[model samples]
Target: MNLTQQISEDMKTAMRAADTKRRDAIRLLQAAIKQREVDERIQLDDAAVVGVIEKMLKQRRDSIVQFEAAHRHDLADAEKYEVSVLQAYMPQALSDAEIEEAVSEAISIAGAKGQQDMGRVMAQLKSSLSGRADMGKVSSLVKTKLIG
Candidate 1:
């Protein structure tokens, strides 16, 4: 089944299980996917769905960071819960070792010489690493490999 169909079934399961937090998160996700489709007038494949989920998770992570910095643990905890819910839909995350290997490969392929070539290296790695690894972490990895 497609991601949309799987999400529909998961929503129903969440509802039946009375998991309000998960159910609400899933609803918000579905709404975002629908909005993107309507805005672009295109059908989203699994990769697109993963992209949407990743965007939401990034937002939640930012929120959590800001809230914690502001000494608002309550709000940060809420964002963390949503983060966990969203992560369930994503593929297994890449390990640090795996991310490093990919970064090295991208740098070599792009013939990146130094930090100036970050854009080239990142462009090459984006699609291959998306949803599997965090770009912020990947960027640091690329920078480390390129600078030395």
Candidate 2:
């Protein structure tokens, strides 16, 4: 099944099992996906769905940090639980070694020479690394590789 169909199935499962937390998390995700589709006036494929998931994950991580800093463990824990639920749909994360190798290959493929070529290199990497690797970390690696 496609990601959307899979999400729908999971949502049904969550509801049937009386998993309010999971169900609520999935509802939020579905809302985000639907909002994006409405705003863009286009149907999102699996890749776009993954993009939405990543965006939500980033938001939750930020909230977790802020909540913890404010000594709000309860809120932070809730955000963490949401993160766990959202992560179930993400593609398998790339290992550090694999990410490094992919970055290196992307750099070479883009013929990136120095810092100025970072954008080209990143654009190349984004397509291959999206959902599987953290772009921020990949960017830093690209900078280090290009500078050194």
lDDT for each residue of candidate 2 in 1-148, tens digit (9 for 90 to 100): 9999999999999999999999999999999999999999999999999999999999999999999999999999999999999999999999999999998898888888999999999999999999999899999999999999
lDDT of 1: 0.92
TM-score of candidate 2 to 2 decimals: 0.99
Q: List the residue pairs that clash in candidate 2.
A: none
lDDT of 2 at 143: 96
Identify the candidate with maximal lDDT. 2
Off by over 4 Å in 1: none
- The TM-scores, one per candidate, come to 0.92, 0.99
Please give, for residues 30-140, the per-residue lDDT of candidate 1 as tens digits. 999999999999999999999999999999999999999999999999889989888988988889889888888888899889899999999999999999998988988
Assess the local accuracy of residue 136 in candidate 1 as a C-alpha lDDT between 0 and 100.
89
What is the lDDT of every predicted structure here?
Answer: 0.92, 0.97
Backbone atom clashes (below 3 Å) for every candidate: 0, 0
Native-vs-model 2 lDDT? Answer: 0.97
